[model samples]
Every structure is written in C-alpha cells, then in structure tokens.
Target: MSQERRNFDKEFKLMTVELSKSRESIQELAKELGIRAELIYRWRPEYLEKPEGSFTGHGKPRHTPEEAEIARLKKQLRDVEMERDILKKGHQHLLQGRREIYRFIACQSSRFPVDKMCEVLKVSRSGYYSSLKGTVSKRAKENQELLSLIKQEHKKSRQRYGSPRISQALRANQVQVSRPRVARLMKQAQIKARMVKRFRVSTDSK
Candidate 1:
C-alpha cells in the first residue's frame, strides 16, 4: 500500500529551521522531531535567503515586511524565554555547589547551549569542560575502590550487616576504614542493612 505524504505549514518549517541553527546537529534534531534530516537541510537555505517567501504554496499570500519583523521578534523572545528558564531552574544549584551547577548544566546541555548555561550560571567554561573530563582526585579513586569493597561485603552478608559489621569485616581483612566512613558510603550507595523482626508468642490464660 502507498502511504499519503505529510505536509507541514510555514510556521512549523520556520521553527524547525530556527531550532536547527541552535542545535549541535540537524540529524539529532530531526530524530527527536521524528522528521527526516534531509527535509531540515533543504528548508534551511530557503528559510535563510527568503524566509517570507520560502514556504508559501500556490495561491498563498506572501508575508509583509512588518509580519517578517514580528516573526523575528517572536523568535528572539522565545530564545530569551528559554535562557530565562534555564537560569530559573539552575539557580538552586548555584547556591549548592560548583559541581552541582556543572551537573545541572550537563543535564540540560541537550536543551540549552553549554556556553549560555555557563554564562547564566556564572561558572567558567573551562571548569565545566574539566568536570566532563572527570579529572578524578586520589581521594575519589580511593573512595571508589572502597565503595566496591563495601558493595561486595554488603552482598556477602545477604543484606543483614550494617555499616558497623561491614567496617569490622573490612578491618579484619587489613583494610583501615572507619565505621563512620563506611556508613557514609553505604548511605550514598543506598545500601541499607535489612532489619529482621523479632519473633514473639502471645499466651492466653483462661
């Protein structure tokens, strides 16, 4: 069976072309919008050279200069609104920590430009890129290894051992770790010890 062709209006095509300008790749945008990348590539030039007359089919009226100006203003307004939203949402992370702010930027990278996020968040672009590169410190590497051992000990105990017991087990194996550190790592990993309920019998006297 032959499928019918789909048609998009001028506004949607123009919006897509504008989005393509901001995105890293038109192919990614097309996949997200469920349209062919070729369509966006084809529309980009026409939209750039003569946006007012680009998508007008037969018998359709061409846009006036005033209308084109209004469309341009609307696009600018949309961009401003998007940046405003990114700032609003990322404000809390700014108060939290630099790493948190970097994480927020990374989470929103696909939606907003990284440079814009860094500017809005008052973070250095080099710091953000450095975070991506993950220059792990010696302490971080040690903690990761400790966390792996914690997980193994946690599982070996069948979730019956808390941080105290885990700490003792590690110490027995010549691992110099404190109970408090074990507890903190366990909490971070969400590896809580399962509690067993006590059994009690009730007796009735007549």
Candidate 2:
C-alpha cells in the first residue's frame, strides 16, 4: 500500500472506532454505504489487534506511583528554586530601591530637585512612596532601634562588617535577630561604611 493509503487507513480506523464497536457488522455498513466490505474488514483486525496499553487521546494517562512521585518531586524542586531566586532578586531590588529613594529625598530637600531626581532614578513617585511603607508599627520602630544598636556594634567592631558580621555582633551583645533582618536594615540605612578604594601601588625602583 502507498504511504498515503496507510495514513488514511489509520485515520479511517480512528474515525470508524465507534461504528466498529457497535453491534452492526462491517458487511452491513458496506452494503448500506454501497462500498467494499474488504476496506472495513482490513482495518477492523488492525483495531482489534491493538496493544492493551495503547490510548486514543480520550482520557488521562495512567502513571505508576514512582513515575508520579518523580514528576511531583521535579515540579516541587522547580518551584522551590524559583522561590529562592525571587527572594534573592527581591532583596537586591529592595536595596536598589532604597538608594533611589534616598536620592529622591535628598534631591527634593537638598541640592537635587525632586522632579530631576525622579527622572534620574527612573522611578515614579508612587513607587517611591510605596517603598516607604516597608514596615509600619511600634514593633517595626523597635526593630529599627535594634538595627541601630547592631550598626553601632558593627561600627565599633569594624566599620566594614557586612550584615552577616553585624548579625554576629548583635548575637554577642544579646540582641536577637536574623541575618536577613540585619541585611535589610543596613540596606535601608545605606550604610556600607567600609569603602576602601583599590589601587595598584607602583613600587618601581627607577
């Protein structure tokens, strides 16, 4: 048979499944449609001889327990990794947003104009105000106060102690808080105090 005929036969098998499954015989349908019975008979055997596990796109796939578990674990792992990346990005965005906010405020009150700052920062006033609502409560104020104490200690220990070291210093002073929180406050204050500019010392003995 030609490839085209074979493909047509497969489609004919699919289209004729319901009619084939009915009680009426292929010979009866051939007589009713005035066509050859051989065409129907040829495909009928192919349909009957189909493997038990084969599907015709009518229902959900049946999976083994291990396969299902493996799929579920893979999806869960993907979701968790996505969440971690989102958290990291959010932290970085928050820090950058804080810097922009500081510049905005500084411009409005100091040398830079608010409108000019807005243009330079490439952020709208609404977004700037929204970030201002980072925390709002007495507890939040207390957290800021605790953060200031940590900063004081951090400065005393070493001006360049990043959030992690500041968190350690907080622990040593009996102030309990997470490193993430320390990092947040440091970001908010924009206090990256230790800033040593790198330069190659030219010790050429000429």
Candidate 3:
C-alpha cells in the first residue's frame, strides 16, 4: 500500500519548530503532533533563515517600515486639508452664525488660515489685521467712550445714578443713546450705582 502526502500550513510548521526547541526530543514532539520528524527538521531551517516573514500566510506582503511611515504622513496631510476646506465656507453655518462672523473667524484662525476665514466670512482682511493690532471697531470705540462718561457721571452723583438717571445725564450732555443700551453696557461693565435708602425715625412717648 502507498502512503498519501500531507500538507502543513505556515502556522503548523512554526508550532512544530517551536515545540522541537523544548527539552523534548524531535521524534517525541513529531510523534505527539503526528508529523514526520524529517519534515519538522526541514521547516526549522527555513523559519530561521527569515523569521520576520516566515510565518506570514500566502499572498500577503509584510509591511516595510518606510511604507508604514508614508501611509501615516498621507493620512495626516489629508486631515489637515479637510479641516482647512471646512473652515473656508462662505455660508452662515459657521459657529455663532453670520451675526458674529468676525468672532467665529478669530476663534478658528488659530488652526486654519486667517485669510481664508476673512474671505469666507465676507470681512476685509485689513480689518482683521487691524483688530490683531489692538485697534477696536467703531462700535467698540464708542462704547468705551460712553463707559468713561457713565463712570464719571456715576461718581459725580455720589454713586446714586441708576440706568435711567445715567441715560438722562448722557442725553443732557448731548450724548444721544438709548436707556436700555446704557443699562446693557452697565451690566457688561459690572457697574452698579449705590441705592439711597430712606431714613426712618420713630418718635416714642417718654
């Protein structure tokens, strides 16, 4: 009778070689694994010659260090470009909406391009540069001047001026502004006028 040939996979061959390394004799391990001892001896030299790719299954190439580094850098570049494009939308879908376009641009400019942000947000690049140089907008400058006047008026009135009085004083000085605006500014500045309490005296019979 003729004996049929047996085919062993890479994993089986590797395990057989590792088991042969033990104190157990090759014949003993081969007998236990039901594989011929001569076949195990032949697989051992092949594994030792190239251990890195020895046990890899068929049709799959081992990834070299250079290829892995290139893949990682490609992924990083793709992510950065994606974020840059997302921040360059001219629509009002950005954070804080179109009302605070400059504010949103300022926040996102740290990561993306500031020129792209300004162009997308429909703001002049020069204005953004001026803002970076510590130049305040017209409204902000006006508010600062109004705040100084409010502080002075509040002090002159002995800290007794509320929003209504402050508004009256501002109008009296020909500085036209709404009462609610004054109140809002005062609230933002955390400025509160001292409230005058009425004196109460009780007359008791002696």
Assess each prediction's global lDDT (C-alpha) against the native. 0.89, 0.62, 0.77
Tell me the tens digit of each residue's lDDT in model 2 across 31-125: 76555678667656555666342234431234569979999999999766654544443434445655445444543445444444444445666
Ranking by TM-score: 3, 1, 2
* Model 1 segments more than 4 A misplaced: 1-87, 94-99, 107-125, 200-206
Superposition error at 81 for model 2 (Å): 37
RMSD of each: 15.5, 18.6, 16.6
Give candidate 3 misplaced runs (Cα > 4 Å). Answer: 1-107, 119-124, 203-206
Quick one: best lDDT, which candidate?
Answer: 1
How accurate locally is residue 159 in candidate 3, as Cα lDDT from 0 to 100? 86
Q: Mind giving the per-residue lDDT tens digits that candidate 3 earns over 30-139?
A: 88889788987777876787776765654133557997899899999986675557555534555453436666667667776777666655678888777668777789
Worst window of 10 by summed lDDT in candidate 1: 52-61
Residue pairs that clash (backbone atoms under 3 angstroms), model 2 = 107-112
The model with the greatest TM-score is 3
TM-score of each: 0.44, 0.30, 0.46
Q: Of 1 and 3, which scores higher on TM-score?
A: 3
Report the lDDT of model 1 for residue 73. 100
